[model samples]
Target: MSASVTSTPVDHAPRVPAAPDTAITAVADMARRARVAGRVLGHAGAEQRNAALCHAATALRDARAELLAANARDVAAFSGAASFRDRLILDEARIEAMARGLEDVAKLPDPLGRVLAEWTRPNGLKIRRVATPVGVIGMIYESRPNVGADAAALCIKSGNAVILRGGSDSINSARVIHAAMQAGLRAAGLPVDAVQIPPDTDRRHVADMLAASGLIDLLIPRGGKSLVERVCREARVPVLSHAEGLCHTYVHAAADLEMARRIVLNAKMRRTGICGATETLLIDNAIAPVLLPGLVEDLATEGCTFRADARARAIVPDLPPATEQDFATEWLDAVMSIAVVDGVDDALAHIVRYGSSHTEAIITEDEAVATRFLNETDSAVVMWNASTQFCDGGEFGFGAEIGIATGRFHARGPVGLEQLTTFRYEVFGNGQVRP
Candidate 1:
């Protein structure tokens, strides 16, 4: 996706007030505003919401220079791994992608007011289940600045008001992005308070959001495991958890060696910092010697390191030994853990033991084997002959995702427009009395 818009240096900073006396008070105030805005937005027509999304996309493109400048400040201030820096930095292409994402979301069918199901009772009562907005949402995410754009776009299209609280690492970028979103809302004659961010990136603010049970209808924490775990543990509100992405790519015994090599390399090395990137390589022991060496060389060429089990070390002696903890870890970098399994069953067993249930892929040409892998592997997304890196909201064609949920309830995989809504029953009754 791309946007072809030129930008000039200008300050389009939004008109936001200072923080309140306490984080709790600030969250309360923001939530109140969002709740009020949400009621108006929910009743808005789909055309109006789509217009807002388009305007926001244009606003983002118009503010490209300012957005990049803010991101540069964020990138400079960040003190983390190279992979994390990659997640934080935004260039011309990424900015264009963000703009395009919003436009794409605008083009999607509106999620609200759809009759999911309808039925009539014997008493002549008609009832229909209709989709509706999830109301005010609290979005807490980390360094990826594009997350703010994606979340806002999805929320606006789904007719929900959102309050974004990005991590300090990317707060500058988030603020500018938030400004662009507000500009879009204002242009469409929607309430600007419909989308907001906290006054500052303080740790206490997270607590404030987490404790806002009645105000924030739903809380989504999209970041590292610690962040998700903390929110799940303490948040008084309902949470749609985006857990650690300890994804896997398994090379089946019936796999094509060449295809397996390509899939494994892309799954692990294509932006290794992303949650969808494969962190573990499970290969069948029958073809470990023929396929493992080539796969290792391919990833190693791309600066990937490995922690190998003893069985794998026998195939390649120089590889570092892997421990139980290493297999269970989510290494969001150019590092992977390898293990040789007996076959598909052993692979599935290993996954059941250590996997995060986010995404798992099997490389095999045999239809039966692929079917079993796809059916039996317990994950939000299961792939055959594909890269685990394909586990993205944009890749899934939901415009853009707020996050890939690892949990089973509410939503799984990419949390997109439809997933952001709840349902209500609308009934049409006759004037007949109860018999």
Candidate 2:
């Protein structure tokens, strides 16, 4: 799940102080509206849906000043760590990126109404599995306001309506963003309820959303470990877990020194707050004496702190000794844990022990070793000579992602247009009766 700097979200919307039952009723009513909207969106033509996305993009761009103002308020209200604040603050470039994200989603191939597979039955009947929307998606996220826009746009393009619950600190920004999305829907002649947020960011509303079993088709939690765990444990509806990103970057014995240095720096420091940032570094013992110093120096120069295992500490004696708990932690900041392994197998074993099964990368020139790492590493995304940060929906050419699922079933990795859809069988038969 996404991490938040603040525990209590600032309320931007006016509150009525409703009873528990009232909150439940309100959530159900909103979900029912979303379900209705989802049906309309799901059956709409691809062109119409794309039009809505383009309008949304336009709306986002036009509302740039308003968004920036709202985001500034959110940032001011947030009393969190600097890294998380970085995630919350939005600038012109980030807003433009979000707008472009919607446009990019509009340009992608329509995921609906396509034939995923076709087969002929022995009885001369034609059967095809056709793509369809998952109906209504419940997106529970934190800090990043862009998540709400990205989720709304992706859900709209894939023909699903979304109910967003952004973190408390981001309530002001979320409201402005949600309004822009609705405006786009209205301009495109689509139901405005297709993209909705609750009246307030009450913690109780989360439970209400969780209990909306029949109303919500799927619940996707995109926050910290606690948030994901709670959703997966309590949600009555089907859930896709966007678990922690305890990612790793391994430097193999055959790794290019220059390449390893560059990849390691980018993977850990490019954007330290994101889920794809490398939290752990595993280096081969064979190359540690020669490669470890330079790598450590590079990361330290970028203000990165280290927690080192005995083997790693042996190479860099001044490094803080890493406890087992440190290896398991997702710092989500500039802190990283280092382990010196014997070889690829050792690296793999360490990863298996500590990784979140999210993303991992190997820095090596040997094709055989790269292939082995790629094939053997049990992660949603495995890269060779590249940064783990590349495990993003946009980089994968999906425009933007709803979230990166760590779960095994249904959707895994970056959830995009295609991942947002499930398929239904369409069978054609004529004059067929029981023999």
Superposed Cα deviation of residue 60, candidate 2 (Å)? 1.4
Q: Give Cα distance to truth, residue 58, candidate 1, Å.
A: 1.2
Whole-model lDDT values for every prediction: 0.90, 0.89
Tens digits of lDDT, candidate 2, 1-435? 111112223322233344457434667877877877888888888888888888878877878888889899999999999999999999999999998998899999999989999999889889999999999999999899999999999999999989999999999999888887887777677887788898998898899899998889999999889999999999999998767999999999999999999999999999999999999999999999999999899999999999999998898998999999999999999998999999999999998888899999999989999999999998988999999999999999998998998878897898899999999999899977768
In terms of lDDT, the poorest run of 10 residues in model 1 is: 2-11
Please identify model 2 stretches exceeding 4 Å from their true place.
1-24
The residue-by-residue lDDT of candidate 1 on 42-150, one tens digit each, is 8999998898888889888888898899899999889998888999999999999998999999999989999999999888889999999999999999989999999
TM-score of 1: 0.94
| CA error at residue 34 for candidate 1, angstroms | 0.3
